[model samples]
Target: MRDLYQRLRITPEAEAAEIAAAIERCQHTALKADAATVLQAEWRRAEYDALHDTLSDIGRLRARLGLTHAPYWRAGPADDFSLPPGPPGSRFEEWMQRLNRAARAHNRWRRLRLGWWLATLWLATLAGGVALGHFVLP
Candidate 1:
């Protein structure tokens, strides 16, 4: 059995060259091992374990905060999740702004819809009253 870092063939604080080499090594090793099996390896170092647990804690924190996805998990062509390149909280604030704007727009639309229904009912009642008065009186 191999630790998580061992399964991934990466070391803590690995240099770029080491990371590249380790990635290649892991790909080769991954061929013979199932992902589940590889990930089941016991921790070889306490520090790696702590780092993994910290990531897990962040996942829990995101869930507790009602976030659907973690902002730091960039899955782009040029992925850089190790450390965020942009200013901290900028991406989160952007996402929050987007959500708030959408919510505000939806609320406006909902109010408009409710207003339309109320106006239609009022017009229908007024027309009914006028028709009744015309039929009943001179």
Candidate 2:
């Protein structure tokens, strides 16, 4: 028999339609009552976690785009209202400014670390290839 978690995995995005289908499948299947109960609990937990994760992503995007305040709901405006640019070096600016001085410093550190590891691997492979060639040549 398929595990309850496997059944729960069928439901994606916690959509009502998908979840409903999963619940129906679970109810019709002749699975052990304990396993089914455990799985139903996990399904709700996963749904809650998925919702929290989505909300966090939305909040991050809003922060990155400098939408700290909600837009005013105008009944009928004569002109279009566009938001102005945010302050320099703020959250939005930090998210926008690629390769900034601070970011450059961190990137340089990362490159150095990667380069060191890559050089070590390259030397090891070169040594191994030379040893094999020497043994196989003669």
Candidate 3:
């Protein structure tokens, strides 16, 4: 009869409560009360089940609970969504490369600054020694 997925704005994988809420949420807009009858009316539910037997467990539960269905199923398995390791130039690798570049640049700058200060101090000492020898030695 009616495509429950479209009528309820849910996937076949949706739980009983999810389907009920979807139908309820769309009642005024896209959902027709007749469409939700499958969840409420036993005859309508049988018709829906007979028409679509391949529904997932959640779908069957939705049919049994009718429109009054509240979410009975527990949350599905938790997913970490973590990706496997990648090759070079990937996100992690790129971040590491940037960090290394910053460290190297900072070290080079420190060495250059230290060398400049040491050279300046050496020149001042040599000039002082020369002045002392020229004036005091004579």
Q: Tell me the spans in candidate 1 whose CA falls farther than 4 Å from its real position.
A: 1-3, 6-86
Global CA lDDT of candidate 3, please?
0.60
lDDT (Cα, tens digit) per residue for candidate 3, span 40-132: 566766667665664444354433433222345223211111122444455655666889999999999999999999999999999999999
Model 1 CA lDDT for position 110: 100
- Top candidate when judged by lDDT against the true structure: 3
Q: Which stretches of candidate 3 lie over 4 Å from their true place?
A: 1-13, 17-81
What TM-score would every model get versus the actual structure? 0.42, 0.28, 0.38
Per-residue accuracy of model 2 over 1-138 as CA lDDT, tens digit each: 233334355533465556555666555455435334533476755664565456556646655567654355322121112233345566766655753877888989999999999999999999999999999999
Q: Tens-digit lDDT track for model 1 on 10-125?
A: 66555545645555566455532542343334443344457666765665555444444355544531221133333445556678789999999999999999999999999999
Question: Which candidate has the highest TM-score of all?
Answer: 1
Clashing pairs in 3: 39-66
Clashing pairs in 1: none
RMSD of 3: 16.0
Report the number of clashing residue pairs per model.
0, 0, 1
Candidate 2: where are CA atoms >4 Å away?
Answer: 1-100
Q: State the TM-score for model 3.
A: 0.38
